[model samples]
Target: MALSTHVPDLAALELLLGVAQEGSLNSAARAAGVSQQAVSARIRAMEAQTGVTLVHRSPRGSRLTAEGVMIAEWAARLLEAAAEVDAGIAALRADRRARLRVSASLTIAEQLLPGWLASFRAAGRVGDAAPEIVLTAINTATVITHVTEGTADIGFTEGPQRPAGLHGRVVGHDRLAVVVAPDHPWAGRRPRNPWPVREGTILQGARAA
Candidate 1:
């Protein structure tokens, strides 16, 4: 069940607990690093919120009435649970930032990524606590799949067209060199115009020509 709207908030409960522990508003404010008036106001707000007179204040000091002591006990337990929740969330964030999952095409992984990661670290862009890099080398399609499926944090692949359903930008460009025998006629041709060759025949027919 949801907590009732009448329940005091965590801050107010903390202030109430402070008063209960310190035995006086002035001492509670000192322990909390707030002014005595702020602590007194917080206690009054808690009382109004819960409709219970929580603190009995006198010139001598302050004290928790019987109802106030019981409420303070419940607040202690709730605060403990809140602390555990805070710790759990912090651990998850630390784990998420501590490691990176990267998927890349095999060629890029083998030829480029090592140097890129080294440069990234040298630049200190990710701060002194760099995440551990977990690299997976696969075919380009699989790399795209990993990224689109959310199995990978990021992916690197070589192609002119962007994969569907994913955001991407070209990090770098690459080229394929057509090597030929020195004696071949095209070897010395050095044509200024781009070669007009089909994708399939670029390598095979060039070698034959």
Candidate 2:
């Protein structure tokens, strides 16, 4: 539902509550970082807008009348609810930031990522709010696609070269070797490294382990 036109704005309500709490316009103005004139003007405006006398201002100081006290009490409740709404929105934003979306190849996701995530959680490098990891285990091609298409925040692949439109770094290394049976002649005979290929599994993210 739309807000009622009769209600004062938050700033005016806040000032009203401040006046009630401080028991003086000058003190409320000082607390609100405004001049006393401005505070008086705002209170007058609030009274005009609500058609209610909200303050009893004297030469010595200012005081809330009976109606003013009731209005101030209602304003206090409204301000508290506003504060709760603000805090809830802030927490939602924090939760969104504290999530890490990851796309990794099957090998890295299955063989290596679990240990890395465990260590990352235990290290407390990101302070108390450790990021929740949303991991997607897929083939190397799809991993690159996820990063390129912006479906994933980070990606890992077993490709030698970096994918286009994305920065890459080698987080971990592995070697590929030919496997043979014990009865096979190549198993017993020591041969020079047939294929000396440096396999780099790149993990693309804000930071890598």
Candidate 3:
């Protein structure tokens, strides 16, 4: 992993933002609920990694340099992303005991599961009152396996393998497609080859049929 790609610990990023706004290392430390000396060490470590002088220290206060402005902006965004991640995990824990436990393939997991679950909750389909949904991602076969083993109350699959003991319900229709940039000559063709996508990439998802 590249060091630049390495997101610094959240505490340090918070401290940096505080220092930028407060204009004093001591004040930043107090705002962040850390020792003034600890704040000094954090600033030193951050500067060493990025090779930019983020703050100019004086007897009265500290001021951010030009590079510091850019770093502070990006750091603020990182902190926001971190908070979102935390909230997502918290929701998972809270909803784990939901009335409906659903397993689905990646396609349905990303595009359909959220909206379906929301509608299900609004309509209270699983039970009398609003029921929470516990959603999981798996391959087509895995979804069937989980359902059979009683791991999931319901499952959605795309491919054509119907294992014994469980009934397959055709809930919806889906079709895969291939397309390229508008400038490509094949843009006029109804059916294009999937060769446009390199490994680890999918050119298109289902279009509105």
RMSD of each: 9.4, 6.2, 18.7
Estimate, for each residue in 36-57, the C-alpha lDDT of model 2 and write its tens digit: 9999999999999999998887
Candidates in descending lDDT order? 2, 1, 3
Q: What are the per-residue Cα lDDT tens digits for candidate 3 across 1-209? A: 55664456777788889988887888888888889999989888988877788888777667788888788889999999989999999888556544667888888789877887788778865347677677789887777777777777778777544556676655666555665799899787765444332111111112210
Off-target runs (Cα >4 Å) in candidate 1 are: 118-130, 139-151, 161-169, 179-209
What are the lDDT scores of the predictions, listed in order?
0.77, 0.84, 0.73
**Highest TM-score among the candidates is held by which one?**
1
As for TM-score, the candidate ahead, 1 or 2, is: 1
If scored against the real structure, what TM-score would every candidate get?
0.71, 0.55, 0.47
Provide the lDDT at 63 for model 3: 78
Pitting candidate 1 against candidate 3, the one with the higher TM-score is 1
lDDT of 1 at 151: 72
Error of 3 at 59 (Å): 2.8
Report the number of clashing residue pairs per model. Answer: 0, 0, 0
Better of 2 and 3 by TM-score: 2
Clashing pairs in 1: none
Winner by lDDT: 2
Clashing pairs in 2: none
Query: Which window of ten consecutive residues has the lowest lDDT sum in model 1?
Result: 200-209
